[model samples]
Target: IQMLPMLVVVCLIPTVLSHAIPTGDKQQLQWISKTEALHTLETAVRNDKINCVVCSTIVQGIRQLIEEEQVEEEIDEFLNKACVTLDLAAPYICEALINEYAVEIYFVLERVIFTPDELCGIFVD
Candidate 1:
């Protein structure tokens, strides 16, 4: 078929390089600097190629800030809006979550900056 060559070129590259390079290399998460990370967010928000690994790396950096309490105001809001909303709902032909979905829950506690003095509890009286 005429289309056979085109498909071969696309498929063959990754298939060959993948075998040559260690699988761990592909899995390794590279740390990007703060400015670069922000740029990634801007690009990822619109781009089709953004995946869980990319999102996770950025989220981890933000989480680190939340842990350190270094930048209370700026980091918390960003964490809630961005990381917490990640959708790991699955892939085509298999609608299952491969990525563990916990950014939002963790962000709620860690990035709140401050909470109310009064805690509410439900009591069946």
Candidate 2:
């Protein structure tokens, strides 16, 4: 039946929801939250599934977040309105920042935060 496809997708929703986030590596990217976005990269790298696929995304996200001003504005606004200070705020910001350029923002800010680049070199290293 033509309806079989839609029924299959519908049937899978609960299963998908049950394990919403795939544990190991996929092209999928996790969102960023914390004083700096590097924490996201750190977590991703530590995870068995995320470490490999994440390097390029981390570099790309960091570059994009800083080079693009509009994205920067959006993230700043998100931080303020979303109560980024709260622990619960992580998933919300993570959700909002999924495609946003946060790693780049963190990269750029590192210069401001650390006079000695080596201290923060762990990010790119």
Best by TM-score: 1
Give the distance in Å from residue 15's predicted Cα in candidate 2 to where it truly belongs: 23
Worst 10 residues of 1 by lDDT: 116-125
- Residue-level lDDT of model 2, residues 30-72, one tens digit each, is 5433323334433443452333233333333333344454344
Off by over 4 Å in 1: 1-31, 77-104, 107-125
The per-prediction CA RMSD against the true structure, in angstroms, equals 18.7, 17.0
Name the runs in model 2 displaced over 4 angstroms.
Answer: 1-48, 71-73, 76-125
- Candidate 2: C-alpha RMSD to true structure equals 17.0
In model 2, pairs of residues that clash are 24-49, 25-49, 61-104, 62-103, 62-104
lDDT of 1 by residue, 30-78 (tens): 5434455445544654453444444334334433544555443343333
TM-score of each: 0.34, 0.26
State the weakest 10-residue window (summed lDDT) of model 2. 9-18
